[model samples]
Target chain A: MAAGNEEISLPASARRLLPPFAAAPFGPLLTLSLRSLARRRPGLFERLGEHSTARFLIDPTDLSFAFSVVPDGASAVVRVTGKSGSAPSDVVIRGPLLTLLGVLDGTLDGDAMFFHRAIAVTGKTEAVVALRNAIEDAELRPSDLLGLRGVLARLADAGILGGLSAARHFAADAPVAKAGQA
Target chain B: MSGRMELVCPAGTPATLRAAVLAGADAVYCGFRDETNARNFPGLNFSPQEMAEGIRFAHGNGSKALVAINTFARAENTDLWRKAADTAAVCGADAVIAADIAVLDHMANNHPRTRLHLSVQAAAATPEAISFYAQAFGVRRVVLPRVLSVQEIAVLNRAIDVETEAFVFGGLCVMMEGRCHLSSYATGKSPNLNGVCSPPEAVSYVEDAEGTTARLAGFTIDRFGAGEPAGYPTLCKGRFTAGDKTGYLFEDPVSLNAGSMIVALKSAGVTALKIEGRQRGKGYVTEVVRAFRRAVDAAESGGDPVEIDGILAGLSEGGRQTTGAYRKTWR
Candidate 1:
């Protein structure tokens, strides 16, 4: 398991290319979130194995957050976590934080929450919301970020984003959009 | 296409069951008035005696009765579902409609001779998912999700072995059935487990300073003027705000009327046309079933589909009807 406190120095070129926020808050946030997530290495691995099935997990460390997709019957786990502050050595997140992470990842939707109410946070609602927004902004595709490289191969014929953007656009406006726009 | 497509109808009570069968339903589906079925309303569904009698009555009239045991079974309380399966099998129903995997396994294991139809509550929208169920549990027919177009249905028909049943009229569900969690969020009970969504107990209507807002479990679903008809309070049809806009984000309050698409459905290889209003009165059931029976018979006899435009207009929800997902152009 990767330790959060492990010093990872970026290349000089990478540092220069990073946005100011990425260096200041975003970098630390990502590092902390990753390290915290890594602390739950076994659970994260378990979730990753079941990504195609229905099980989900959310991990929120002190400075960052993460989620894992565990396959239903598989032995392996796949995890994806991100944060907004300095990376820590070890971290733990509440169950609610884990569920919210699944929602932002698009693995879960509003209707799912509306129906199940699977995740509920107790302490800091705004922090969870912020974490959700940051993860959405990151736009990390599960196939790419997670070690589901073979899953991406199956979907390769469908194109890079697999018509996600077009579908979103269509869902937002659809047939009524043209008439409404006029 | 071939013969007249079967008009499969819903009957919440024995009265409605008899009415639908006599009015022209080739088949009627009902459930035990318990949590085992989706329409677990207070007065709806059948008693075991009613179910046995309903089956005998339908059979005597050359019609079939299907028992719906469609609710998802809890992990520990599998006995309730097993008992429902046993009762349906004992009642001599033509088929038992089920959704839960464990329940399906139970039926297959216990009553291997009994026919199983996949309930719409399974939400098996894709061919792969549907095939998975059919292969696993010997599901003879699948009541497909309402999301597919006629073309999609045709394509699926070519791939799967089982017959397909589809909604041709009555209430419209905006999201996938069985998978919906909206009702559970507002109220603790859900369709998957409790077999009721937006239950009457949790629904309330109040005329406030703004308007008459229909609420489900205290959350506003829709608001109507004094003159406008207030629709049922379901979580999906509720008016809510998302980024400042406040309106129906899921679907407008409307019933489905596929009267004009009888020919298209026949061409698409749909074996059964389902009418969905178990909570309605016998008159509504008789009228709708009779109209559809006439339409289907006419179309089968190489005649044009019968038109009951004015009669049906009065029965529609809010006096509005949509073709729903049948016509791809709606998407």
Candidate 2:
């Protein structure tokens, strides 16, 4: 297992090619929102059950970075990195950002995506299965998962989501943005 | 001909139920979101509220809904299964497909008007077993296990008075449906007990440059090469090495495509043709039910049902399909 604490130093040339989202505050905001959502619904963690400790790598193929999550139900941690880069994970789910969001929001059927081979899944299937079930069982949309409320929730569903729908247009070396309560 | 054989479809969720109904299924089978049914997978099955909605939807569309309370009841929680049957009856489901005697007894005694259809899990292929269930529980229909031949089914249907249902499509279980313990041995989950085989929590799939490998409980089920289609990793379909050759020891990763035999099955006195996969989604339900509806409708006039075979080829497991024991090609 690769250590999360292991230092990753990128050369100036390598750094130039990285996605700008990797340098933004979106990662920390995602982590905080996840923790807040866990507080809102501990059942999400309860659903993960035996796979609570497992690390999941959610790779949105349209985005250059991936989110690594350990939804421990309490103090859950979600981290976004430019690349997984061999950091060991219990499971890895790779698919289009829209599809991933659709699954997260309970709009897409995970089994159907799997059958159509729209998503590439690997590693500890138990955890992946549990995670997918947890998400769908909660029926949470991006607003819910992000703990976005009221007008912000509306923005999440429309403005932010609409912007993300065009995430492909974002610079390959984009920087992070946003922060939230954990 | 006894007219068009009923096209019984699987409805794993509320969405799938509507899809099946709109696609021309004569009937759709589903279960509560509990161990009372054989397809007790996570995020699958319906709530009582959902079940009511599904039943109403099916009814409005001229499709019947069959609730499956098929799993063998655990002694401690027998009432849970009974409650499911009662709920199904209250929801006015067309029938309850059940296997457990206690569940059957409860439905028979408590909800006398609720029709009973013996689930395949009961493995009641013999004349005596089928008759006993019918006599004791007033079982009106029986979903036959997948192991029997068409000839064997034709013979058995003659000895029985009730309607017979056969699995004409979807994933094949090599073992007697109710008797499989392979998943229990490996992952402590059994279809009859927990209503799962090679449960999602115990299965793994690793894809890499070498293609993909599926495993259950740390045991490798099968390894697929690049460009090869993958199937769900059930133990019965796993590849194993015997004395010399290494291959699928029990059965290959092939789907049971009995479309061509819709006429033969009707001739065998089969009342329904079941398309298994309650754990599947709306896309699968719509596509499969449509193809089968065409086949069953065509078979009404003794027309060939093979023309629609092309539509089903891509939907099969591992992109491979077989007639199973229907043709008895192995014999």
Candidate 3:
């Protein structure tokens, strides 16, 4: 077991709950993130062809990559290499992409993947807008494994999602509770 | 034996651009409305057409216009940045202020005649890094990061061939520019790449049964009581619990007020003094530029440092100020 695992375990009720799509270890999230990437691959290829100088250096397994886009938000170059070796071929991506590959590949967290740095960019500023629009437009919602309304709804039902709420309530109500007793 | 230091001023609009020029700014820096500049806030910065007009107006008054295209360029979007650079060149800008290495490389290669001023966003705080940019891209000037003291500035000025610009007054950024990840941790955007830090979009205020708290990207950064003045929610200035103490760990919400340090800065051999705040209004631009202009003029005339206390008190952040790293204070 990991160092902290001994301190915590799934409650009997929580254990009976089905894992969400992304919470089922890495398998489903990886597949979903990859599927999202594959869906956008055609657009990526078209964007890559538009820029002569743009290139991407990605470590899909490690989630580190460098990419360059053309001056116009039309084409890009992406290289995803292994830790020790060069990339296979400088893959191309279209302008303004969310680039789910990093999150799927476990190189980046969900937040970082959605945020700016996960998709390291160099070149034009409009490409950022385009990329943001594309990703947001995709609305890559995390899968609802048990067909719950949403990720939050499922997590709330599972009883594991309220740690922050408990922590916040404890921090806020501790003093109030003490005063009430006094 | 120090050469006459240049005094750079900010101009948010064309009128302020004229005000800065008429007030005796050696050069005026402004940015286009898009993400090309660090001050990407709405209602601030000039449109491309306005930038052309501002550049013309400044040049007409015998002052130079330095276009700030300092934000880090996004990958696969090089065209916008390239066009920004090209536009500045065509608009007769005296120089292009940039922070990214790739942007510098592009400018140096494509527009060889256009002067390049390295923005503070590069965080080239060390002599070696400044020297490296100078050697690599022939950068004419480097806007030194806000982490250096007067003595350090003198030492750095000696080591590098490029001219150095140091902030004299206005907002203070505690973290090393171009190096901080705190903003990215909270907001998806960062100043280095996105030209914004602790962006307004990611901020929220929650007044619960306990107290009023400011949250950034769902993390409670600061909490305020009813009487205390609530400040803009920046990650560094926010109150947080680190260990037993729940207070500002990084820095207080204070603007940098360096009006009293003009003599030290002049003696330190800084080539230019930059005033930060491009989001400020025209009145702010007028007052600050006027005050600094008087101080610089007084210093040049061998007069006592001009008193500019009343002029800029209204424009300070949280109505509080500090000399920042210029004075070595433990707190």
Top model number, TM-score: 2
Relative to the true structure, how large is the alpha-carbon lDDT of every model?
0.66, 0.77, 0.62
Residue-by-residue lDDT tens digits, candidate 3, B72-166: 88997878889999999999999999998888998899998999999998999888898899889989999988998888888887887888899
- Give the best candidate by DockQ: 2
Candidate of highest lDDT: 2
In CAPRI terms, where does candidate 3 land? incorrect
Q: Model 2, A35-66: lDDT tens per residue?
A: 88888877556656778888888876555577
Q: For every candidate, how close is chain A to the native chain A in TM-score? A: 0.29, 0.71, 0.26
- Candidate 3 structure, TM-score to reference: 0.62
Q: What share of the reference contacts survives in each candidate?
A: 0.00, 0.23, 0.00
- Rank all candidate structures by their DockQ, best first, as comma-separated numbers: 2, 3, 1
Worst 10 residues of 1 chain A by lDDT: A1-10
lDDT of 2 at B120: 91
Q: Work out the iRMS of candidate 2.
A: 9.2
lDDT of 3 at A19: 26
Scanning candidate 1 chain B in windows of ten residues, the lowest lDDT window is B224-233
Q: Which order, best to worst by TM-score?
A: 2, 1, 3
Local accuracy of candidate 1 as per-residue lDDT tens digits, A31-143: 34444444433323221221223323344321223444332222324345443122231112232322333344443331123222232222222222323322322333534
Docking model 2 quality class: incorrect
Model 3 — interface RMS deviation?
A: 19.2
Higher-ranked by lDDT: 2 or 3: 2
Q: What lDDT tens digits, residue by residue, belong to model 2 across residues B15-38? A: 678878999999999999888888
